[model samples]
Target: MAVVNIRRDVEDQFYRYRMPLLQTKIEGRGNGIKTVVPNMSDIARALSRPPTYPTKFFGFELGAQTQVDDKNDRYIVNGAHQADALRKLLDDFITKFVLCGSCKNPETDLKIMKDGMIIRDCKACGKRSDVDMRHKLTTFITKNPPPKKAKGSKGAGKAAGQSVEADGEGVASDEEDDDEMAKQIAKEAKDTPIAKTGKDADENVEWSVDTSEAAVRERAAQALSGSMQASLVLTPGDDEEEGEDENSPYSIFNQWLLANRPGGDEGRDDLASAEIYKKAQELGIEKKYKAVQVLLQALLTENAPAEVPKYGAVIAKMTTSEKHQKAALGAIERLAGITYPSLVPNGVPKILMALYQLDVLEEEVVQTWGKHVSKKYVDKETSKKVRKAAAPFLTWLEEADDDDEEEDLDDL
Candidate 1:
């Protein structure tokens, strides 16, 4: 991965090192002649040149800024385009966040690549589009940041050891209880007090077990009588039922909606999935920013299939989700309200969350920025080559429309 810091490290340097260069050299800081120089070489030329549009210089043509009435128009149009691009690079590097390509959406699933080009698919549309490197230029300088790790710590290994200890305790259920039934039963009764009278602790009595030879024989005979002569009883394993809808009432809901998220649409009734609605609510989707987004996707409307992620109770059951049963009740709240009116607000948050999930500022990121990079950053020889690299991502957006079936994160 290319080394880059999305928030601080790169931003700190861009302001200190790169920005000063632009202020003192290109903008002139009130010291001298204003002109457009093509490349860094032409930057030193200092010859007077024409004024030009930002996008026009790179051959893409984004648009224009306020015009300087006093300066010569010719000087405004030349190498100024490249200088402006360099400035944008610094600004983007210093940015706190970057948005998705199509919608300029900051909250996304992740960056995706199609045809060997990196693009960001919208969390809302599921349609892939080119990444907008223009917003934070340093993001481009270090396109893929180095993976971060902590010093003197083994995160995964440490967690595994704790898990193994827990597993050992859990395995007790599988081990055979070899102790004689009478003695074993006596130990359980003596150790674990039972509430026979319900309220007063003093009302409970200590269990009395007789280990006398006659008593042991009596208990042994009863146990043997209860034992099967040729035992063949089968108990279903819970692990076998996992990921299967065979015995679960909510399993159908899991299959139809919650599990198809992230990869693609699963053709389910997302709105009707009452169980998932409850999951989002109990997880505090109505309160936290990111949780709100995750919840909204679970309750999406018309354009459903375009964006959804798989979800599992174990995975989704974070601190954000406490009221799983409550959230589920809310999912079908609206339908219930139509009949009883009280159920209206039960899952109304789910609908509102889904609504806020909509995004719109994305398409313009590429068309405007793509041109500037070519003229300013790309060498004349290579500018032609790099411009086409953004094509695959942009082309996909121009062709695809959203569908209606969506999935929740449980599927993953």
Candidate 2:
């Protein structure tokens, strides 16, 4: 079993990370031709994905149905596929799912967020990159979520806490009584007169809770009856603040966009961006340039930079400070160079230049970013490629600085 770099572009035989070459077998007659990926399980193990994912990707690419036989480790595609073609498709899978979008490293884990967005957590660079939501695989990953960890695992406590929080306020299956109480409370609130003045008046008004002897007896009787149980009243503000406290504005906006998205894939990026802008305005955070940072994070994925400018107008309106600008640029670095290198197009230098001209990023920061290379996200060669992409911007910044220095000397 000869091994090769997960990224075949790196032909280095000594590349540390390696996977076995794809092996395929063609079987059956003309009408029933099918391709079996004999070593797909082994390949998937190397790539750290469920074998079915790649098998399904094969089916998707070849326009054929696929059968994943996990029990026997047999994955079959309806049409006969060449080993080379499958290998190429496997590379596509690596780019989209396996490899870290930032560093281009294959060491990553898939995390499905609560809002149904899939993120890749890169082990090497310690950066979490979002997967593009527009892909067909996102729907599959959401429905057929990754298996839950063993109860005693490190995340067990967090999962349990989340479960408890979800249980708060809204009991999923409460019968007639809870509904009746809610209606009674609504009726009382509607009937209650508004106070003309505050301070001395009804500053703190309690909702619905009966403290009478008869009410107590009724509750006791219900408990005793075994047919009914006491329903707990949650604090009014508790559940309302849960969404805000637990999630960032960007996260909420992202979920909202996903839910209320328009029909058809045409101009989806534009529509999503417009919706985000609308949300920002509604929340009164539109003027906060930092809002654009959140928007940038939610909208842009390693493989999808086309939507980067969707919020460009909103970003331009903000009076961003140097610190905020640096943070925004850092987000781009994480997305383009570190988390998703291959997916980031060559226009990154142009994007940086545009931002620099707009005063969104300073020359010093841009130069520093270009010169600093981290192999954690990529191999030396790929790191060099990232640096090369930043070269033009770095050169322009250097020349500008030199010209300024010369002008100062002439003034003296």
Candidate 3:
């Protein structure tokens, strides 16, 4: 079987992540037709995910029903999907679930928290990234979690950071071959007479570090500069001060919103927005485009469509250019598509309309945003869905522009 990089987008031939090429076979006739993935288990094992995940993802993407028989190792999706089509869809699945958000490495483990949130813990970068819970497959994964690995088991050992040697074909070499090779090497070592030179004797001796106070002080004096020594000395409450600065400005702002519960009380909205703006200024991130995204995400609630106008003053203050407006739109994409997906397919139009009415987003920017769907803030699928929800509002804007042109002609 031919293998490809798990992240097929990567053209590097030597990429460590590899999986078998997806193979799809059409079965049955007419309405009963189905696509069967014979080697899904093998591919899923390579990805460190359950075989049912990609299978279900295919169903969701293609608008088809899927069936998984774990005992028989059969995964099927209704409808005759071609191999290339399934392969393309599989890439999207890998992007949304397999790849680490921070490092883009596929070496991650999906962990479900007690709060019912799913996160991917990357083994390579040691970053924990939240999985977009809005995707339909997340509910299935939550209900039918991946099987836990048993302690000291071969699979567990492999999963727990053990490196397995693979052959040219990208398959793990047989354990029997390793055992035989080890035994042969041991026999040859025993048969040969041992020669111990001075260097060899030295290699056999263990090394230890000197830890006496005098030795430590001497080493510190030689290595540490005055500034370095002064920096190492911390006074009381220094840890708390350092911890506050350790968090990103956006993260700190989010925590502040949670603690203050802004936008909950009437007539205090402007005061809250002003305080938020002051906080942004104090953090020195007031001019950053990302601050707009964080602001919208932190301030907007599930009823974002209605609340957008309420916070219009703050939005106008933060978004001074097209780039900032785009960031604000990206925030809406994340909010509707990932954070509050339940409001999608209806809430987006109202939200966009509110922004347009408040002049927070320009007509040109809105038109450009509706025309292109990118995976900058959300997955491509979610991006497309969010844009689709905004289609009606976009159409209305276009029609209004055309009507204005006709009115100008009549005036002439």
Candidate 4:
């Protein structure tokens, strides 16, 4: 029956977000022992996540099987776990899957995109954050998405401005208020001479327009002399300008990434990977591989080597194919060689290693990138310089591959 702050780290006594303390009851004996979370539904309700999610997370963390009895409101995990231990594990679940990456608020909803990516849509900050797709629990969540709320429910009625009284009387909603205001306006308008007899009264008033040729010429002369006429004049580069505007989504996303860089705020990291993905969705570029390229160029700065790992989850979710991997490499090329030329000789290797470690760039893709210098991302000379800078890392990857191949031969 005891309650605790949903985010245990936020020890503010007046914190609004609170959940029931996790209760574990162990059943059976020896190998048949299982840990049961009696108040998991209560905890999950407070967290706004399904009960099975945390239960499955416990199973993954403890290397045990989990069972869910939705009808009985029961969740079981094989192997006996203490309340404190399970509570700690639940905190891990909250950190990874519950808290928003931007504001650390727990008022977030887990949304599974059509691409099978799970993102936390934070209601507090209105930022969408990506979950670490590499986690095993993501697979389970994708398979079993949260149930959709029924339409036209009480909550929907309230949202739509429908109010109900305790005595079953219906109050005037926003629509009714607007209708009354409109009727009052019409009645007031009828008192005036303009609305006294509708169109018949208006015809009694005389109105005329000067559409003579001399008058038209005078109007044209005035318009031509005005500053507004400049906008009407078309130039040879109008098509190109219009095209650039058409591609403004990528530019807009890039500007957002630049403005909201991680560590921009004091004592907080603003790595809004899910927010970036959400922006891509809004721009209709979530499925485009090129969007990943924009993310790389916009996010990583001079300290790209240190920053790449922080956005690993973001890159992993966006880069799902070899083309995306290559696009990511192109962004890196532009970053080290063109954007920050000081990173040419030394920082490039570390950046490559970071991306490799995060599994954002595959071995073969890196090798292929290092083998040739194309003018696709940067000028040929800059491309060559970037490739030259990446040689040491490329050599290391080749050596590692050769060792792997040698091990295969020895086994054969």
**Ranking of predictions according to TM-score:** 4, 3, 2, 1
Assess candidate 2 and give its lDDT. Answer: 0.56
TM-score of 2: 0.38
Candidate 1 structure quality by residue, lDDT tens digits, 1-412: 1222222234554321121233212344343423333232122111111112121222223233322322332223222335556445433422322334543433232233434444543433234565444533223324443122221112111211123344344334322232353233333333332222211132454435798999978754542222111011111121111122222222232232334433225644333334555643443232322332223223332222123222222223421432322222222121222122221221232222222222211334433332332222123223222223223323333333221112333344
Which candidate leads in TM-score? 4
Name the lDDT value of residue 131 in candidate 3: 90
Candidate 1 vs 2: which has more TM-score: 2
Error of 4 at 130 (Å): 0.5
Query: What would the per-residue lDDT of candidate 3 be over residues 1-412, giving only the tens digit for each residue?
Result: 9999999888999776799999988999999999999989888888878888999999999999999998798899999999999999999999888888988978677889999999987654457899999999999999988655432122211222123232112222210123443333334333222122101122443556589999878654532232122212211110011121225565666555534544332324433567777887776557656667767775666677767877777788989888789878888887777666645665777788788888898999988777665665666668667876676676678778899999999999
Model 1 alpha-carbon miss at residue 114, Å: 9.1
Q: What global local distance difference test value does model 4 have?
A: 0.68
C-alpha lDDT values of all predictions: 0.29, 0.56, 0.68, 0.68
lDDT of 4 by residue, 205-273 (tens): 455659999997875454323212221111111001112222355566665665567533233367667
All candidates: TM-score: 0.20, 0.38, 0.40, 0.41
Error of 1 at 105 (Å): 2.3
lDDT of 1: 0.29
Superposed on all Cα atoms, the candidates' RMSDs to the truth, in angstroms, are 27.1, 25.7, 29.6, 25.5
Better of 1 and 4 by TM-score: 4
**Which regions in candidate 2 have their CA more than 4 angstroms from the true location?**
148-412
Q: Which TM-score value belongs to model 1?
A: 0.20
